[model samples]
Target: MTSMRALGRDRCLQLLASVPVGRVVFSMRALPAIRPVNHLVDGNTVVIRSNLGGALASTATQSGAVVVAYEADTFDLDGHTGWTVVVTGTARLILDADRQARYERLLHPWVDEPMNCVIGIDCDLVTGYELAPA
Candidate 1:
């Protein structure tokens, strides 16, 4: 049997930083869209690099700070042990040159494309669950 437990905010953030990739859920054309991107946890924020022409970047730039959910997880099917984290927050483009440059150095794109945009999601409420052996 397996058991599940709730993870606190700080613990959730730590788990997020341990992972390399996650899904960023945002709105496009009034519809929900999800993009898989690698990220870095900065303090209590999640940062991702994206192409300037991408839908995410476009939406973020046009809307300023947008509400979104960032989710990431890892699990072992055989063992039924792992954790899932979902973060609800506001995302905004890092437009300042210095900050953008700093993020550019800290984050690397997984795809072979130019990622000219750096967005930060300030975590407002972080909820997570961990499954483990009972």
Candidate 2:
């Protein structure tokens, strides 16, 4: 039997901050879609940048509630030990000038068009799991 482990907020934040890339999940027309994104943890929120196109941008603009999942795992065939961290939370578009500026400093846009938009997810409800050699 395999046992599941529950991770605390501190662990979740630590894992999220350590990784530079994650997957953002959202629904488009009742269909689930996942996109890879580069994010940064700002205090209790995760900030990411994107261009004007894409389902993520459209969903955020439509004021749709989205669940952004940031996950990371490590595994070795010989060691048979690894861990995974997952963070799920509501997502929204960042429009405030001050907040946008701060997020911009923390998350640099890698794409063209200056990444005229930003998406943020508050880490109000975050959970994770880990499996390692005991």
Query: Total clashes, candidate 1?
Result: 0
- TM-score, candidate 2, is 0.83
| lDDT by residue (tens digit), candidate 1, 37-73 | 9999999889999999999888888878889899999
lDDT, residue 78, model 2: 77
Off by over 4 Å in 2: 1-4, 64-67, 76-78, 112-114
The CA lDDT of each predicted structure is: 0.93, 0.76
Which 10-residue window in model 1 sums to the lowest lDDT?
56-65
lDDT (tens digit, per residue) of candidate 2 on 19-127: 7887777678888778777888888888889886777887778765566665555556576655566677788888899998888887876555658788888786787
Task: Report the poorest 10 consecutive residues by lDDT, candidate 2.
Answer: 68-77
Query: How much is 67 displaced in model 1, in angstroms?
Result: 0.6
Give TM-scores for every candidate, taking all chains together and pairing residue i with residue i: 0.95, 0.83
